[model samples]
Target chain A: MDNHLFLPILMPLIGAALAVVAGQRRMLARTIVLLATLANLGYGTWLLWLVDAEGRQATQSGDWAAPFGITLVADGLSALMLIVAALLMLTTLIYSFATLDGDQERFFYYPLLLALLAGVSGAFITGDLFNLYVWFEVMLVASFGLLTLGGSRGQLEGGLKYVVLNLIGSTSFLIGAGLIYGVAGTLNMAHLGERLTTIQEPSLVTAIAGLFLFAFGAKAAIFPLFFWLPTSYHTPPVAVTAIFSGLMTKVGVYSLYRVFGLIFPNELARFAPLILTLAGLTMVIGVIGAVAQTDIRRILSFHIVSQIGYAIMGLGLASVAGLAAGILFIAHVMIVKTALFFIGGAAERIYGTAELKKMGGLAKREPLLATFWLIGILSLAGIPPLSGFFGKLALLQAGVAQQAWLITGVAAGVSILTLFSMLKIWNEVFWKKAYTDVSQLPRVPAGLMIPGAVLALASVALGLGAAPLADYSALAAGQAFDVSGYVVDVCGVAGCDAAATTVRQENTQ
Target chain B: MTLILSLVVGTLFAGAVYLMLRRSVVKLILGLILLSHGVNLLIFLMGDGLRRGEPAFVDSVTGAVSANAADPLIQALILTAIVISFGLITFIMSLAYRANQAVQSDDLDDMTLTDKL
Candidate 1:
């Protein structure tokens, strides 16, 4: 049963090795990646079902036992993230085919892609802290290859800054994990959570938590630490940028949720104030930067930071409702953001540029593409009956409930700015008359259009089916907010019992 | 002993930071190497100052835990981190080399085409 949890991580890793060995065979590599991603999606659905039916699943690899050996656990939040990642991987693999040329496909694209997918899945499901860091390294290295593969001067420059900043994040993550292990006498996340229940040194734990905040904060691209994102993210090829826009920073956000939500619950009170302040600042700065950008991908890249602010704000609220909102909004942003990038990519392809000024008359040239763009735009703006609406509504409702007046106001303001920039894209890329000599422009291929169309439809369907999604998110949120059950599931009943007794004793005192 | 080790870590970190702030990409890579070494040493010191004299090895016959064994988990962790950082530094070195060759400069300030607002 626990082995079922391993498949999502394993399948991609095995496929990556196989595809790398089958290098230069574009047809074979593409087929391998697409099939592996599809298999992963199916496996993700299965794992979600099992978690839904059986509750959080747990397994300690090699029978070394809990708090001693490596553990893999998947609860509601992990499963939800897993399924979304699988779906994104599947869609983007197909999307890459349409975007990457034959030479690019054979340039280890499929291998690096599968490796990244594996790393992300491994991060989502791992039950140990150090393992999460290891998975992050895996994901980071693959991303570096993909980001710099073209060896263009711009890509190399961008990749340099990216690696420099990311290595700092990685080092901090390792140091944090080490510190936690030393102070808490455990490396297992469940064990750490259990041990931290009655922490005598709250400041020490909070200091470690601050390190994680820096580590994950940089990865998630929050404000004051987000310079690397807009600079480098726009330099990658469209497929690479689109998927990075979707998944990479969210790994940071997810880690933030995990570390704060579970292992450092005792430190949250001391840290929440700083987190809320950062969330507000990240949102304001991200969208304001986006508003000033003229390039389509560059604008979308800035909005990624701003949207991340909303995701973390939920955690900053530190309530069950807030976490549910954060998780829901995270999934919604991942889908909608990917679709927007695809729309931007398609527009860039048509005009042979990402500059909004040079692009126009897409509405006249391609009505279907325009409709897809509108759905993404509307969803991003939180228009009703769209996925983004529910995501924002839940978050806003949570903020109002918490009486977080300032952050909530900033969030609302950012939403308007988001809509305005998105409109700039629509007006310049589609709604306006053709500004360029487009006679030489090729027709927008169905391949490029279909990926965005599918994701755009998913955004709408996510909205239409928001009820079930909200229910799942609420269940996941419950699992995140109170993680004693996760501790028991991973570390066994004995560890949880000891932690519970400590908690009870502390409460009575 | 712990104080002395922490001072070493601090000095390494300071040096790494100073190097990382320079304009040359090679300095940045050197800083990164020092940064990683500083972190690895920090992790070593973080593991409770290495009390035991030998590696933690269980008895073959009785399967009993070694009484005087060190905390091997952190050592394992540092080993893994070393390997990972080794790969990373190589990648960064090559990336820096590539950027230098392509742009005809190693100074980050000169690579301003991608940084425009």
Candidate 2:
């Protein structure tokens, strides 16, 4: 039964290796990637069903017993994330196959993409802290390749800064993991969570938590550490950028949710005010950055940072309702952001540029494309009956319950700024008269249109189905808060005993 | 011993930061190298200091744990870090070289803003 959990991570890894061996055969590589992603999506759905039917909180990987070897545990939160990731990956793979040239497909694109999926899956499911760091490296290495895959001047320049900053983040994660192992004498996350509960050194715990915050914060594109994202993400091709925009930072948010809610609950609760402050600042700064941007993709990139603030703010409230909101917000953002980027890509194709100032009156030429863009952009701005609205509504209610009035105000203000930016794009690109006579622009191919429509439809479906989704999210958040289920599932008998002894020793010391 | 090690790490970090802030691409590469080394050493130190003993998990130990063994996991982790950082540095160096050849400058700001307009 636990073996089912390994398929999501292993399938992609095996596919990546196969693609590397297949090398220049673009057709074969594309087929293999598509099949693997579909298989992963199937497996994700199956795991969700099993968890739901059995009322299982988490699964231990293999019969090898947990904590001693490695485990892939999928709780409600992880299952939700896994499903979102698989869907986004499947859609993006289809989009890339239709759009990117054969040469790009052959050279490191498919393999790195598969490796990235493995990394995200592994990060979501792993039960060991050290294994989480390893998976992060796996993801980062693939991302490094993807960012520079174009080898253009802009790509190399932006990719360099991206690599440097992320390397620092990687180092910080490793050092923090090492410190936790030193203090707790275990590398298993479940074991560490149990041990952390007994430790009396509040300052040390805070320092360790701070390190995690920096490491994951950089990955999640939170405020001061987020400079690398807008520059680097904008350098990639739109297909690749869409996946990164949709899935990658959310992996960071996932880890933050995992560690803060499970391993360092007391620390997070104590530092709630600080996190709330950061969340507000990140939102305000990000949208303001978006408002200042003239390029369409750069504006979207800044909005990624701002949306992350909503997820983090949900966690900052440190309530079951708040975390549920955070989970729903993450899912909504992933779908909506991917759709917006697809539209941005299509708009770029039609206009011959992504600069909003240079693009006008696209609606006149391609109403279908404009309709997709309108749905995506409106959903992104958190309009009613959209996925974004329920996420923000849940978060705001949670904040109000906690009396975090300042954060609620900032969240509301950021929503308006987000709407303004989306409207700005609409006015410039879809409403005004064409800046150039682009009627001669070739019609968008059916292949590209289909994927864009699928993602846009997904955004709406996610919004309309918010009631059931929110219930699942709430269950996940509840499990995350009461993480003893995770500890028992991962550490089992012997590992828990060892961890208890270590915790007792630390308390005595 | 911890104080001395901390000072060394701090100095390396300061130098790395200074070079990272510089305009030249090569200096930034050098800075990354220094910073990674500093981080590697820090992780190594976190393994409860250096012990005058053999590595853990000897071949002959079956039923008993080695009481005097040095922590081998940190050592393995450091080695992995070293290898990964090495790959990243090589990639960054080649990227810098490519950027220089294409744009005729090692200044990042020049590359960024010029492309924007």
Candidate 3:
């Protein structure tokens, strides 16, 4: 059963290679990508079920044992992340099938999408920090291809900022990995966790954690490092933007939760206050930034930054409940944000412009589209009976439990602004009368709206059925914080001692 | 020798940061290449400096390599880093060239087409 764990990482990789080989045959490429995504989704659900029943599993590649060879691990957290990723990949690929132009289809779009999947899935499964860095590069390279496609002046303009910032982010990430290896003498995460607990200096490990935070900070689009996100994210194709907003930044947040909770549990208190401060700032600034944007995609981009604050707030709360809430919030936001982007894309198809100033009458023209969009909007603004409300309530409750008054205030305030801005989009883009001649507007493609409409419906379903997801997240969080169990399971009994000796031997040599 | 090597790595990192901060897109790409070099070197040094030790394969009877020989895993990681960074650098160069072709400028400040409207 442990051996079956590599199948999730392998399937997308095989699928990607085939997709690239079938590049000229557009139908073959799309079909392969669709099948691969469906298979991955199935595999992810199975893996989650297995983990739920059996707990965490680990497998070292090449038949070598742990701490010696590369290991892949899957606990509830990884399984949950994988399923979320596969689900997004499937929905977005379906959306792209109908929406992407012939020009894009002829390009390497399908292959790049699969490659990004491989990278993302690989990052979640790898038990080694250095391997995680490698997977990050894989994702980055694929994104470069996806982002810069079309070569429009705006795309090139946005793509450059995205490229440069992310490259720096990768470099910082590499440096951090190096520092950790130098300190710990092993890059295997379980080994690192074991060694970290025994090490005398909390500050040293915390310092490395800070480096990771900065590196991932740029990726997650946290404040002071978030300029790259709003500047470039609006420039991508709506399908691309949907996937980007949905999965990419959350990967960074996930890593933060993993590394701090797994390898640096002793240092959480030192990091929590700072994380909380950043959380509050990230929320206020992100929402305010959204208010300033006139473009549909741009507003959503800023809100991505703000919603990230709630997830980070969960990290700050630093309790099992808090982390669970963070996990739930991240999952909730991923679907809502992607659905909103899809709706924007669908609306853009009809209105022929992304500028909210120029577009209106969508609600009058397409009430289904408007109503579908309202589920996402209402859910995002923390309304009751919606997914976002439970996410916020959990965070607010977690904050109260932790005595984090400032963040609780920020969360409350941000919800109001969030509703205000979302309503702004509702008024300007959907409900308001058309700005120009109404008959000149293009027809809303029913096919394109279907993907987002389904997702919007799913968001409501998720909201109504939020309890199971919250329970699942709490279970995942339990797995994350139980580092001793992880070290024992991944490395085997007393493998922690064996890993430490190995590190010592490496240093002396 | 270790001191000089580390100094070289530090110089590469410092210079890379300087180049990355420049307004020119090409300069930014060059900075990244240098930064990767610094990182790869840091990782290489992680395996430890030259020490008096024989290859573990000398003891072929037991099939267990001696601990004294440099562990090959860190080097393998470094090689992987080099290849990945090389690909990233090439991609960024092409992306910069494409940006230049599209916008007719290498200056990042001038590459703000989407932000102005």
Candidate 4:
């Protein structure tokens, strides 16, 4: 069962190679990619069940023991992320079938998409910090290709900012990994979990922690470091943008959860105020940016930043409930945001533009799409009996429990702004008089509408069935808080405590 | 040896930041290259400073690695980082070149088609 840990990462890589071999055979490539995603969905479900039934599961590569070889470990958190990612990948691929141009389809689109999935899965499962850096680069490289597939003027411009900023972020991550290895003399996360506690240099560890926070925070698009997200995310093809919106930033958030929650609990507590303040600013600024945007994708792009603040808020709270709320928020946002982009993308396709001024009265022409869009935004705005509402309620409840009144107030205010922004999109794009004759406009194909509907319904289902997910997130958060079980799972039953004692003795000597 | 390497790393980083702040897209790619080099050197320096020793190999006699050999792990890490950065730098170069051609200027300000409010 532990051996199956690598299956999720491996399948996409094999699929990518097969896709490359399929070459100009577009249908074959698409089928290959679809099969890989489905296989991963199966594997992810199984892994989640295994982790839930058992404790954390770990497999070290090539028979090497833990702390020496690369370790792939999936606790509840990793398994949940893997499953959500696979679901999004399948939905995005289906959406792409109708929206992606033949030019892109023929030009290694499926291959690159598979490669991106491989990277994302690897990042989720890897138990080594350096390996996480490698996975990030793999994802970034594939994304660079996808973002600029058509070589359009807007794409190149957007891709440049995306590439440069992310490269810097990756470099920052590399430095952080290198320095942590120097400080703790181990790169494996499980070992670091033990070793970091014994390390004597508190200030140095804190500084390194700051480096990591900046690196992952930049990638996650927190507050001031988020300019690249809105500028570049809106420029990609809607399918490309949709997948990125769903997976990429969440990976950064996941890293924060893994690193701070597991490895540097003390640092996380120390920096809680800073993290909370950043979260507040990110929410306020992001929603304001969204409210100011006229382009459909651009508006959605800014909302991504705003939504990320809520996830980080969960992290900043630093309790089991806080972490669970963060996890739930992440899961909720991943589905709802992607669904919005898919619906927004379809609207963009109908009028052949994303500018809100040019599109109106879509509700009358595409009532079903309008309905799906409403479900998406209402969920996004955290209205009652929706997944977003449960996610936000959990976060707000956690914040109040923690007595983080300022950030809690900020979060409440931001949701109203988020709703206002959604309504602005609604009024301009759906409810208003037609800017042009919509009778002549092409109807949205089933291919596009179905994916959005599926994900929107997923949000509804998640909301309706919130109990199980809430419990699951609590389990994941508990695992994250208690790193001892994780260490034992990865580093044999004897554990690293003996090794840690020896290191401490040597330092004293 | 550690001090000199640290100084070089600092200089490289400073240069990279300076170049990255320039308006030209070409300079941005150059900056990324310099920045990667700086990070590689920093990694190398962070590991046990300059050491003249045998390659990391286990002594069959003792069944343990020779204590004096430079850490092979750090070198392996550097190699991996270098290869990844090399590929990324090449990709960025091409991206910038194409972006330059598309926008008809190397200036970053001119490439605002996507972000214009």
Which one is best on DockQ?
Answer: 4
Q: Ten residues in a row with the worst lDDT in model 3 chain A?
A: A500-509
Predicted structure 4, TM vs. truth: 0.97
Residue A484 accuracy (lDDT) in model 2: 75
Whole-model lDDT per candidate: 0.88, 0.84, 0.86, 0.91
Q: What i-RMS does each candidate reach, in Å?
A: 7.1, 5.9, 4.4, 4.9
| Higher-lDDT candidate of 1 and 3 | 1
Per-candidate total of colliding backbone pairs? 0, 0, 0, 0
Candidate 3 DockQ category?
medium
**Candidate 2: which docking quality band?**
acceptable
lDDT of 3 by residue, A80-107 (tens): 8898899888889988988889998888
**Candidate 2 Cα misplacement greater than 4 A, ranges:** A55-64, A493-495, A498-509, B1-7, B58-62, B114-117
Name the candidate, 1 or 4, with the larger lDDT value: 4
lDDT, residue A103, candidate 1: 67
Q: Evaluated with lDDT, which candidate comes out highest?
A: 4
By TM-score, the best candidate is 4
lDDT of 3 at B15: 99
Winner on TM-score between 1 and 4 is 4
lDDT of 1 by residue, A1-509 (tens): 37677888889998999899888877888888888989998888888888778888998787665667789988888988888888887778877888887767768988998999999999999989999999999999999999998888889988999999999999999989988887887888888888888877877888899999999999999878999999899998898998898889999999999989999876776788889999999999998888888999899999999999999899899888999999999999999999999888988888888887778888878889999999999999899899999999999999999999998898898899889988999998898888666666789888889889999999999999999999988988888766678887876677854744554444344
As a whole number from 0 to 100, the lDDT of residue B5 in candidate 3 is 72
DockQ (Cα-based) per candidate? Answer: 0.54, 0.44, 0.53, 0.59
Ranking by lDDT: 4, 1, 3, 2
Q: For each candidate, give its TM-score against the true structure.
A: 0.97, 0.94, 0.96, 0.97
Model 2: per-residue Cα lDDT over A1-509, one tens digit each = 45677888999999999888888878788888888998998888887777766644445554544455566778888888888888988888888977888768868799899999999999999878888988998898899899889788788888878888898888788778878877886777777778899986768888999999999999999988888898888888888999999888999999999999888999889878888888998999999888778888898999999999999998899899999999999999998898888888888887778888898878988899989988887887788898888899999999999999999999998999999988999999889887688787888877677777888898789889999999988988987877677776666545575645554444344
